[model samples]
Target: MQDFLLHGILAISAIHMAHCNPDKREKYATISARHQNIALSQFSPGLTEIGENNADAYVLHAICIFLVNTYSIANPQGPITSRDVAQSFILLQGIRSILALPFAHRYIFNGPLARWLYQGSVEPAVGGNYSSKIDDLLNLTRSMAPSDDTLTCQSALEGLKHTFAAVSTPQHRKGLVWRWAVSLPQSFLELMSQNHPMALVILMYYAALVYAFERNMWYLTGWGSNVASALDKAIQEPWREWIQWPLRCIREGVDIRQVEPLKPVEGNPRTQLPTINFNLGLFKPSEPPP
Candidate 1:
């Protein structure tokens, strides 16, 4: 397992070096290929062993998989292929399953690996400006769904809040956004699969968050905008209004709050919801909304 992890890390480094110095691409290409082969050989047995009794090892293994996927999709040699996206989703789903285990939280919270993978507490900042927005979204979602689905909705909303907080923070931490991208609870994916309005709204908001990182990170180029565009097209009327602000923000490369707030319609539940805002600064090179 340790050997696989080491190879995964080395593969990531080689890929990054290749990205930075095209002249050495052939050298790094050879290095990345060798490390990737070794990691792939041990991947299955390593995961099986970790699954037996070591939650820490399991999470570490997941991170290594994430790093490898990051390198593949971000490689400048070509456009991101459909296979790359599919593979990332598969690996991310695997991580989510490991996290679902009862002991997973302990490893994520206090384990030595926590410093690298965990994003602090799940608790949102109380009384923070964005808290109100998240709360409103949660409340609205609960109102839309059955009581049994409330937990799922709340969990998804909280995940969105976490993503917002991570992206809003000043630094560009690679794992932060990637964690959110992959770690979303299974319930969230189910809601998305069903095309639930609340779910689409939450996803659109996340898309906007992704857009904010577009200019700054090589790995994230076009990802944010692509997600926003896809969601905007996927969501239909009434709900379309819910995502308009985010879509507009991404299109204009401005913060969502900077877009003109949507007007509330009398007797319309959607319009009554407050505009979502992130107090965190926008990704660099973005102009203030007009």
Candidate 2:
């Protein structure tokens, strides 16, 4: 089983590399041309086409399929192997990289430009009903996130601090959860209403990836194996349908089930923080004390 998993990963990796190597050049050209034509301020073009068409998704999907195949070959309806779990981790990593690129490299992913594009499109119309709230939620989570640029993240942190201050009351926190819980399914339905199946797929897959990462990170950090086991148990559809749904019953706010659980991950610094450079530049004396 392990041999099968290893061979499958190698084959998938080789194929994805060969496939994407040629397309990467073309993809870059297409993306750059699209950006050049778009003014980027008043209007933006979405990943609507690009996201669906990206090589990353194809590569990740291929690897995932291979992983599942390997699992089935080995277990044939029984226990999932470590290889299977590891492959899931790899898939999550790929997805995270794909998602983070939009924010990490604005020149490439261009959040503002994408949002502008969404706004300009007949699809999301400027200040449209769903656009504002969805954008707000995404932006809020992204802003609270820690990232490579200290200044950029600091600004976001400040905004979050202020936002949290304004809405920090226990009641408000509960209300926020309640509101999100109520809004989640509605948002899911809204996406469906637009015939946007990708949105639902992306949302659900992203959520699952988030849960998996949280579990593995905790396990790696020396959290008792029980948490990891609980996570594994949580992913099953039956468990997700029953226990997971009720997990959000507390306080009836923000539907904790809908949001990814944040876990404190302890690991190699290099792995965790690839983009950050810790060196501080030398300080110069101010014009001989003026």
Candidate 3:
């Protein structure tokens, strides 16, 4: 399954590269359909459970995570000295993905795990909750060992922390609180509002983990005297200050008071409504022609 996902993404990337014009490198570089679909679908409330078998969501989720992991492994940004170690870690994650697909949809989809295999089966055309789809994929990924290596562990941890942050249930809050403490302020959070707050939150979560990963890589490359001192410096005020500046500016510019809060609609029993509309131009209603 993991191999299939990797091949699919590579194939798509190759096609995009071949067909795309040289002037369109920037556009093609941003061809992250998998990530976009996951984000857009998840934020929609109407897509909670849309298919007869709910297989579409499962496959989409699986493939996206698989690609993310594959991309991270193939194009590592840090610590290339241990190529063998990194390759083994990637292989480990691949194996875990292949094995976990069976249990991934078992609880929610409630059917044979084999039904969603990558051998030849394709899902139906029903739409799905992108967030929920990725949530399941993240959960499957989380079941794997987190102590694989600094890089692998960092990647896995970041993925799990971000994806689960989407679902705002009581159980998930505990995890969020833990994650929030370590996550530094991020610029992306400024773009998010109540409607899609999870996107901002999740991005920051991974950003924080990556910050830590990069700090460690600094020590590995002998930038600092040793790993301990580098890690200590990473957690110190300098790093925190650097991240805080941009986030603080964004926070100041965005006016929260202007955005009306969600509330129950007046005189409507069935629906929870937004804040009252305050259009000033209309004359007040005069008792409706009694």
Candidate 4:
């Protein structure tokens, strides 16, 4: 299973590179197809193993499938479709479900894979006064979703901080966004469902972080930009002001931290943020699927 995962990663990397260099697309596409087939074929057995008591391996399998799905939509040959976008969300949900398993945290946190998924068990110091920025966002969330459970809001804030630390660091890593995505408490998702302005705003900043490091990898190309745009469009007035900085960062191709902080709207009363279709495909490729 590990070997299959490794091959899938390599094949995806090759596909990204091939996408960048059009000359190799045909050859790498064939190779990628083979890898995808092999990975998919093994997926059932690997899943069965986890179901049959080898539960410790669940994370590994989830990560493997996650990589496969990521590359599939990122393939340069065509634009991602709504179906692809839906599949991406399903894949992420599967990974999140595994991570949420009671016994899974011990293995995920202690195992070597943790290094790839998280910076460490202890929170790393983020550069600048970012904590304040995070706090502001959290406070906004509280104001926006007054009914949201306090504990869940706090967990979401911590997850945001963790993602900020990972992205703000000089070193770029894949899966940081995924880690943050899975770590978000259910309450956070509830906020998103309600189109909480603060929730969308935080996601915009996260998208900016993803955009900042996009140049380092082929798979990350366009992801941040798409997410930022979608969120910007989905959000409405007063709340929209909160995301201007991140949206500007996306448009200007600058780090979001370099942008000025959002000024608080002094007289604004808490109002329900208008919801949009806001599906997983909002960040998926805009072009037709291959």
Candidate 5:
């Protein structure tokens, strides 16, 4: 398991060197590809039969996969396609699957990893100044006329508001914002996969969050402007109105602390966030799996 993590770290380091060390860039880039391939090859098999003991390994492997791909897609000259953002979130969701493993909390509380284990505990805020912005997007989804995709779109947006609320507090962790996708349904992932306009709009919000928090990262650079630009082209006329703020954020780099979070829609339980229990603070059972 550590071997996979080591390969992933090496791959990421080499890519950084490739970009920064121009003279040896080609050599470093080639080394990165080689290590990335090996790490990913190890990851694909690990996903199939995840158990308590192996769950930690899966989580580490997924992080490697996520970082490797994010770096691979980054291009100072190229656009960050909607597919890139969508695929990144998809990889993020893979981390949640590991937490869902039975009795996961035992491992969840490990030192340094504890915050991630319990981050799901925070719910979307009720009636905050910035929450109205999230509300507007929800209303826009409703105004567009209800469809099967509505709930998934709403859910994805709702998750964003929840994340906004989480990050607003002093307890916020560095990678915590990425957890917004952890609650997404397969249906929502499908919508993003389809490049549906509404889904793309939600992705724009994600782009803003990443831009606000992660723009300094080499792989994450330009994600904001590129995602906004791609969405600008991918989304048609009327839909443009809903994405204004995200575009503004991409253009102006708005402080996320001041942004409105989306409140759960009144009377809509589906939009309401509940405390997510990853089974933290539990002891591993003495008996092994049968």
Candidate 6:
């Protein structure tokens, strides 16, 4: 557990050094990887022993492991494929595995997670409450005939929306994106890994959400474009149409708010919703959305 925590800090410092201390980048990355391997060695055995004394540590370890793997794939030096992005979703499912233990409820309410769970009011979404883009995209899953797949897709979309709203205030960066992945079920994760058309469509929005607030993040830089391009190429018609806005945003490397909205129907008199202008400077780079 301590190794996991130590490796996490080192991995984070390595990312920090990419911008703050480029000369020290390789040195920290090397040491971080060595410590991470030691942490990995204990992961399997640790899984079986997640009792009261170890539950908190185990959950933290899950988060650290996911971030480390995601960082490796999202590194700008490498190419990011739809398959590579899928690995991030799979790593997130590992967190679900830990939480499914019999003592899950206790872990959330009685452990280190409580403060976060009971955290105060959440920030609103862009365009106030989910934007029309989200409404249009979600219609595909929301209207699906009820089934395991429908339920899973619904759950994943809901999670994506929750993350979309949570990150809209612009102060959010990095790890907040993990919330969407963590909320998914194993079935949805498999769909994403296989690059299913509908699942990829959902992922396009996930990419847009990342771009919306945190495209500047170290581990997430260019993720929006990489994910959008991969999915845009992989998905066929009808479903492909669902991804245009995000694809364009990624292609242009512009913020979502910077993209012009779709024009309203000729006969439609519904006024376009006004967007709130958030003060990005209100919070430091390390703070949550203001």
- In order, the Cα lDDT scores of the candidates are 0.57, 0.29, 0.31, 0.57, 0.65, 0.60
Candidate 6, clashing residue pairs? Answer: none
- Span of ten consecutive residues with least summed lDDT in model 3: 268-277
Which digits, one per residue and each the tens of the lDDT, describe model 3 over residues 1-290? 33334443543463245233546533543454433343434423323333434443434533343333333322333422222222222323332333334444344345454443322311221223323333443464466466333233334335444433422333332223223222222222222222122332233333332322232231111211121222222343423432232122222321111221233122211111111111111111111111
Off by over 4 Å in 6: 18-27, 100-113, 117-130, 141-151, 169-175, 252-290
User: How many residue pairs clash in model 4?
Assistant: 1
Candidate 2 residue spans exceeding 4 A from truth: 1-76, 81-83, 98-290
Model 3, position 252, has a per-residue lDDT of 32
lDDT of 1 by residue, 115-197 (tens): 66656554444454345666778877767747646677778778777766665565636556655656555555656756666
In model 1, which runs have C-alpha deviations exceeding 4 angstroms? Answer: 21-37, 51-58, 70-112, 119-123, 126-136, 145-151, 162-174, 178-183, 193-197, 214-216, 255-290
Q: Higher-TM-score candidate among 5 and 6?
A: 5
TM-score of each: 0.62, 0.20, 0.23, 0.65, 0.79, 0.72
Model 3, residue 178: C-alpha shift (Å): 28
**Per-residue alpha-carbon lDDT of model 4 for 1-290, expressed as tens digits?**
46556565665665665566667666766776676566556555555344423443555655555654554543323433333333454555666555545555556666666676545543565555455667776776566545645556667677878776666555646556565665655456666656666666776767766776677766656667665555766788887776766676667666654554444222211111111111232121121212
CA lDDT for candidate 6: 0.60
Q: List the residue pairs that clash in candidate 1.
A: none
> Which tens-of-lDDT digit does each residue in 1-290 have in candidate 2?
22323333443343333223544633533343333222121111222333433424333332333233322222122333333332333333333334444433344344332431111111112342223333444464365545433233233323322322223333333112111111122233333234332232223222222232232222122111222232334345432432232222221222222343333232221111001111111111111111
- Rank the models by TM-score, top first: 5, 6, 4, 1, 3, 2
The lDDT ranking, best first, is 5, 6, 1, 4, 3, 2
Q: Give residue 275's lDDT in candidate 6 (0 to 100).
A: 15
**Where is model 2 poorest over a 10-residue stretch in terms of lDDT?**
273-282
lDDT of 6 by residue, 117-159 (tens): 3333455564632366776666766777777776777777777
Model 4: ten consecutive residues of lowest lDDT: 269-278
RMSD of 3: 22.9
Task: State the local distance difference test value for candidate 5.
Answer: 0.65
- Using lDDT as the measure, the top candidate is 5
